[model samples]
Target: MSTKKNNPSALNEKAGISPPEIISSNAIQQIKESRKKQPSSQELIDGILAGNITALSRAITLIESTNSNHLTKANEVINGCLPHANQSIRIGITGVPGVGKSTFIEAFGKYLTSLGKKVAVLAVDPSSTISHGSILGDKTRMEELVKDKNAFIRPSASGETLGGVARKTRETITLCEAYGFDVILIETVGVGQSETAVHSMVDFFLLLKIAGAGDELQGIKRGIMEMADAIVINKADGDYIKKAQLTKVEFNRALHLFPPKKSGWIPTTATCSALTQEGIDGVWQTILDYLELVHSNHYFVEKRKEQNQFWMIETIDEQLKTHFYNQPNIIQLLESTKKAVQNNEISPFAAAQTLLDSYFKK
Candidate 1:
């Protein structure tokens, strides 16, 4: 009867089985705006310690900010949360892109929550070095975990540092720990330089790998292999189950070639399917066993202490580099020096020395 012959919307009713809203968006936005209207450090700390997710997210956002203005506030929040942190077991997970890290974390996180444990996931998404852009779609990928009240999934901060781990990630862990999360899972992007950084941060290092995809003997990386506390061959269902098992055997053999771990815990290797939820519980058991061994041998507390010291020196190196590069003269000279070095005008080390000279002169 109308100008339009038919309306597609009239063909179907609303989905009655849609998931329920945990909290209204309007309510959350209103709360955020109110708190953002000049929240004191202690107020944010109070909210975080009281187990308020919004408050926890806001504090983490502040910590990840690069603005100089937020530095003091961020430091205050970290100092406040420090006393309540180090109470949780931090696990770092890394793998190549398309390794199903997101799916695995979601499945693993849900399993932990089912056991009455609070889980916080800091997931990394693919980032571009040229554009400094990230999709940040991990929250969407982890559909079930996002809906679970006992779980918190945060897409790790992107841009600037593309080494898988996020900026100020350790600070974020402290904040999550203070918020009463029992398990903190840090998911890094790749299996390269980032692994070293992530390895030093967590008590347990889990490497997620898939089967029959450029995963041959050549893929055996001794450096990453040595860092791993557990190698989980994911996507182990369907036709690939046998291949996964073979991969597991290969990894187990490769792990044996490495020296013994200081924690007195041998790296565990197993296969699991995130889709079918198979072997998910075994991963948790492996972690518990490692915890028992490390705790009993006194490596738990000592490892954390060593990590703290490492970060202190690392922060100094980072700040010095940032300060050096921020100088007006260094900014002006860097471009010219880059062109000269690219043209074979100066040795790489000499170019570096030149920049250092200019920075010190400034």
Candidate 2:
């Protein structure tokens, strides 16, 4: 009886290696239970005010959800959080592809957290028009920063908005501020209208460039440079120091050509290596100097008020568009109108008028 009881359940050790559970079953059950108990808006608000990151993330999810009920709850949360926002500095960082944006943000974010500050990173990644999916590796690439307790890295909220920031980004920012983050970093990885949108909302705009051909004259991104509070050349350590200096001088010259900023602060250029963490602290110092000047004047308050008004108008426009597109009558008419225009049977403008008339019962 003793020998029989000692026998293994598999009966043979050489059959195969039994895979152990990588995650505990109890944890999975707990996750399911928590999902079933979806927190109320007021609970979410309280949790955010208390600096709970999990609650903050869930609140943002509600803001991004397309469901009508979710949107209503999201609006309530925003209104509640609004009173606590505008307490943190909003910074937008932009760079063209291959400029090491993710790596730079990681290094910069880590540096900020080391100063006993809470940092939040929101990346604007426009979804592929064809696939409706965004490249989400940006959050994962920030290995050290993501592990930092005071640093929060959020991947892009996927959708098409007017440009710059996503439609729900402002609400997300309010929630983050209420969660007690000192610095809000908006990373604009997408090209085009995104830059303008971000520039309108952020107190500081930074453009990151790599040391490359100076023949283009930095005029290629002239519009972005004009909006930049500062320009920093990255990858400046490994055999690129001299080239980086040259690029910085070129950017400084280009900056002088633009009209003065409303804040009356001249944009500065510098170089840093994200890998070596060189000059990262100086970048923060430059931002502090800007903050000091802007705060001493009326520009900072005026700019934020303007941004609120701008977003209010934008929200109205987005709602009108969404309402128009969601109507059954308009949806059916749009398909036929598109085919008519493509077949050259109707002028595009005339087709648009037809759709509008149908939408308004004209």
Candidate 3:
């Protein structure tokens, strides 16, 4: 009895399964040590283009790094991958906390997978620390769907951005496409204004809401609603079922008050329960309808081009600001200028002009 208990194969036999070799702890350590050389950025890119998940993860890691050394290679990888990008559908989802954003995505992702479509999810945690890295709570939140072989979930470290979107999310989108993920879902921090940043990159923007006592719209900013391509009132089952319908009508009216979408696509209102999976199909159908309308008018292609241009400029602006703030002399100048303004030694506009002049001169 003692010998059987000590034998590893005994456990498998008791469970009616075949026995397998169990690597020793020393062997495991050696394997990990051997992996230290890690693949190069180009190898990762090749793997991504070949649709390797491991390579995709490593490529994203390179893009997320602030290390100066990785930046050049990262750009090269992106340049090589650009020709293969833009073939995927990019969707952005946002809502207040507890609005069931993750649940909705899981259900919708499963639905998409069932239709033989490949889905890649990049869930922006928005609270991750650069020092500690992302904890990836979304993967655990989406337990069922995460197990599906066809799905890929990447939880981004939010860094200092308002949206949970990581600094490299735009590049991550391109990498996902190279990996053959035809449907890419980007989920942002539920905080409303940050939704705008996510909206700027996506082809379709979805806003989720919970049925409430007429105060739902109050918590959501008008700007967010205005940017939304569709409004989904989630948790639309059981106790909230009736209220969901009423909220849908209210949203339809509210959506009309805002200007029409840039694609001339009408905003749709729907109710869904990520728990019971109710109305999930309708939400997807609504998205397809909007996509169909936009594509027919050639807004799809034109809008994507505009988005690419916007991102290029946005990245440049952000890098310039970061460089400006990080300069030791500029930091000292900024502090001195602040004190001068408080003491009434300089007008705010004059200080700003001086700062700009100095900034450019440097």
Off by over 4 Å in 3: 1-33, 128-135, 216-220, 331-356
Residue-level lDDT of model 2, residues 4-41, one tens digit each, is: 66556766665667767688889999999978998999
lDDT of 1 by residue, 204-243 (tens): 9999999998755789888888889999999999999999
The residue ranges of model 1 lying beyond 4 angstroms of the native Cα positions read 1-36, 339-348
Model 2: colliding residue pairs: 164-193, 164-194
TM-scores of the models, in the given order? 0.88, 0.90, 0.85
- lDDT order, best first, reads 1, 2, 3
Considering lDDT, which of the candidate structures 2 and 3 is the better prediction for this target? Answer: 2
Model 1 clashing residue pairs (backbone)? none
lDDT of 3: 0.85
Note the Cα lDDT for every prediction shown: 0.88, 0.86, 0.85
Cα deviation at 95, candidate 1, in Å, is 1.6
Q: Write the residue-wise lDDT of candidate 3 on 183-264 in tens digits.
A: 9999987773468778878989999988975675675567888888989999989888999998988888877788766688
Highest TM-score, which number?
A: 2
Q: List the residue pairs that clash in candidate 3.
A: 126-164
Off by over 4 Å in 2: 1-31
Winning candidate number (lDDT): 1
